[model samples]
Target chain A: MSPRPETAAGPAQGRPRVKRFARAEHRVHRATAALMAVCVATAACLYLPFLAQLVGRRALMVTLHEWSGILLPVPLLLGLASRALRADLTRLNRFGPHDRRWLRSVLRRRGGRPAGKFNAGQKLYAAWLAGAVLVMTGTGLLMWFTHLAPLVWRTGATFVHDWLALSLLIVIGGHIWMAYRDPESRAGLRTGSVDAAWARREHPLWTPEDGKGGRGEEE
Target chain B: MTKDENPARPAGHDDDRRGTPVGRRVVLGMLAAGAAGVAAAPYLQRAYDETLGAAAQNDPTGLSGLLPAGGGFRYYSVTGSVPDKDEHSYRLTVDGLVRHRASYRLADLRALPQTRLVRDVQCVTGWRVPHTAFEGVRLATLLDAAGVRPEAKAVRFTCFDGAYSESLTLEQARRHDVLIALRMQDRPLGHDHGGPVRLYVAPMYFYKSAKWLSGITVTDHVQPGYWEQLGYDVDAWVGRSNGRDDVPTT
Candidate 1:
C-alpha cells in the first residue's frame, strides 16, 4: 500500500485551508463558559450560609444569585441552538479506532499521534457538560417557578439543583485549569484556529497533515 | 467526606503578602480566601437584619411582607426574575374550565373590586417574613367570573417561564380571601417579589405565591405541579403540613 498523504507535507500547493470553527461558535462557547462560572460562584456565595455560618449578605447574595441564574444560561442556550455548535458536537462526540490507537500510545509512551480529534477525556467532558447544562436548565426552571408544581416538588428541585451545581463546579474547576494550563488547548479556543505545529503536537491524529480523517476538509 | 489531614489554619488574616515566599503560595491563597469570607460577614448580617429582623419587630397581622420596623419587602426569587407588571399592561387569565372563559387585563380587574389582607408569609425553607401587605382580586371574584363547573376540582397555574406549573383545589380557589395579587405594600409587584401578578394565599406557605404567573387552567381534580408531584404538601399551610412541625403558615 502507498504511504498516507498526511505522513508527508502538503502537495506543492499553499498552506491547506484550516478547518477553523466559525467566529460565532467560538464566541458562544467562551461566553457560556464564563457565564456558567459566574453562576457557580454566585451560587456558592448564596449556599455558603446554609452550609456553614453565614458567609455573605443574604439579600445581596440572593440578588446576585438570582441574576447569575438568568445571566449564565443565556449563553448556553445561544450556543446549543447554534447550527454550528450542534454540528461540531457531532464530530466531537464520535469515537473511532484511531482514538483507540492514540490511547495506547498515551498509555505506553509509544510515538504515534495523540488520540483522535480529541482524546476520550475531552469528548466525554463536552458531552457530559452538554447534558449537565440541559438538566440544570430543566430543574432550575422548575425551582424558580415554584407555582408550577406543588410545594414538595419545588423544594426537592431546589435541593437537587444545589447538589448538581456543587458537583458540576468541582468538575468545571478542573476543566478550566486544563484549558488555562495547557497552552495548546487554550490557543484553539482563543483564536478560532490553532497553529498547525501546536495541533500536531497535542492532537496529532486530528491534524489535516495526517490525512487520517476521511471527512473532507478536517482530518 | 474525606478528612483534610493537614487543614490550613490562619490567625486573624492580618498578614500582608509582600515578598512572600513563592513556595508558600498555596497556604497564602487559602488564607486570602478565608479573610475575604470574613470581610463578607457584615453583608450577610445586614440582609438578615432586613428580613428576619423586620419579622421580629411588629408583624401583628402575621402577613408575609416586611414589618413596619424592618422597612421593606424582601421576598427572595431563587432565579430572581418576577414580572412586577404595571397596571396599564398587566393581565390575568382564567381558563381550562366552565363556559364563560375570559381574560381580564389589570385595568378590568382593578375596576371590578379590591380586597386587602395581611398575613404571615412563611417559607417551608425555615425563615418567616411576617405581616405582609397583600391586596388584589379575591379568588372568589375570579372564580365567579369564569363560573366553575361541577366537574372541576382544581386549577393549574402556569408562569411566564413556561416550566413551572401549580394547582389549587377548587375549594381553595373559592376561598373568600384567596387573591390574585396586583399590589404589595401599596406598590405594584417588583421584580424580586413575583411582580405583575402572583398568587396571594394568606393562609398558606410562601411557595403558593407563584411568581411571573401567566396561565391558569381549571382541571377535573388536583394534579400537582412540579412541587406537589415531587412531595411538598398540596395544602402547604403554615405549620399545618409538609411534615414539618414548625410555626403555623398564617
Candidate 2:
C-alpha cells in the first residue's frame, strides 16, 4: 500500500474527507484519556505489591491517584459547552432500528445494517464507561474521605471501587484493541476527521449526500 | 427399662418441650456453612496477614491499609525502613523547656513505676485493634521528673527513624492514658510495632502515637505530626475529630 495519509484534511489525489469530531471534542477526549491514564498508573503503583515495593512513594502515589480520579470527569463536563460535542452526545444516547440491526449483525458475525456516527457497540461502550467513571469517582471519594459514610458503606465502596476498576481496565483494553483494528476510527479521533469513502462504508447513516458527516462538525 | 419404671415422666421430655426435633436440612446447612468457614479460614488469614505485612513495609497503593486484617492491627512506617533498636541501644530523652533534661536507657524506663493501659488502638484511616494493652511509664511522670518549665506549652515527639514526628498540647500530654510505651500485648514491643520504646497516645489516632519514638521535647507550641503535616487533622481524636463518627475508643 502507498504511504497512508497522516490526516483527513485535504483530498490526497482525489480522496474527499468528512469532519468527524470538532477540536473541542478532540481536546475533551485527550484530556479525559490523560487523566484516566494517570489514575490507572498511580493505582497500579498503589495496589500491586511488586510495583508498590519497586516504586516506594506510597503517600505521594495515594495523593496522585485520589486527585486524578477526582478530576477524571472534568473534561467531559467542560466538553458539554461545545455544541458539536453536545449534539454528538445526543446522537450517541439515542438508539434507532438500524442500531439494533447492527447489534444483531455483530452477534451473528454477518453484515446487516449501516451504522450512524457511532455504532450500537460504540454507544453501549460510551454509556457503560460514563456510568463506570461516575461510580468509580463516587466510590473513590467515599474511600478518600472515610468520614463521609458509615464503616459498612465505606467497606462496600472499597470493594466496588476495586472490582469496578478491574472491569474498567478490561473494557478499556477491548476498546483499544478495536481502535487498533480500525485505522479510520483512530484517524477520526486523532485528526477530528475521516475519509468520506471510509465514512460511507462504515457509518453511511452519518455521511450525508454532500459527503459531510453531520452532528460532529463545529456549529 | 428405666422408662418403663418411670411411667410418670412425660413422653418426649428429652426431645423438646414441643416434642419437635430440629430439621435435618437446617442442621446440614449450618454444618456446611461452618465447614466452609473452617476451610476458608487459613486462606483468609494468610491474605490478611500478607496485606498487613505489605502495608507495613511500603503500601504505595494505599488500598492495602484500608483492608480489615485478621490481626486487628496493621504496621505502617512512613520512612519505608527503620533501623531496629534493641534494649541495649535504645535511649529516650526528655529535653527542651525543661529545668532538668535527662536521657533514660531502656532499663531505666522499665525500672520506673510502670502503668498498663488497655484501650483500642485506632488508626485515622479507620482500622481499629480493640483492647490493646500498652505498658510503660506515663509520659506525665517523665514530664514531672524533667521538671517542665512554665514556658512549655506542648510536647513534640521525634522518632529514631528520623522522618516521623508528632506533637500534643501539654495538657493532652499529661493525660494518664499517654505513655512512653515499652511493651504491647503484654510482650516486649517488636520492631515492626515500634519497640523498644514508642509513644502511645491512647485517646488520639495511632499516628499521634508515633513509632520508633526517641525524643520528648517540651515546646512552646504544638507542632503537627507527620500525617498532620500531610493534611490529616492535627487533633485526631477518634470520634471527635477527622469528621469521623467512630465510637470513642477511650
**Leading candidate by lDDT:** 2
RMSD of candidate 2 to the truth, in angstroms, is 18.3
Measured against the true two-chain complex, the DockQ scores of the candidates, in the order shown, are 0.02, 0.02
What are the runs in model 2 whose C-alpha is more than 4 Å off? A1-19, A42-70, A81-83, A101-114, A135-184, A193-219, B1-91, B103-120, B129-153, B160-163, B174-197, B229-235
Alpha carbon deviation, residue B158, candidate 2 (Å):
2.4
**Per-residue accuracy of model 2 over A124-208 as CA lDDT, tens digit each:** 7877777677777777887787778766566556655665677888999999899877777777777776888887788867743
lDDT of 1 by residue, A1-219 (tens): 122234222323343334445555667767876677667766655544332123423345545656666666576466666554554555455555555566677678886744544665675566666556655665677656656765544544554455457667778988988876665445455444544655566665553433221122221
Report how far residue B120 has shifted in candidate 2, in Å: 4.1
Residue B123 lDDT (model 1): 70
What is the fnat of candidate 1?
0.00
Candidate 1 wrongly placed segments (more than 4 Å): A1-219, B1-89
How does residue A66 of candidate 1 score in lDDT? Answer: 60
- When summed lDDT is taken over every stretch of 10 residues in candidate 2 chain B, the lowest stretch is B13-22
Query: Model 1, DockQ value?
Result: 0.02
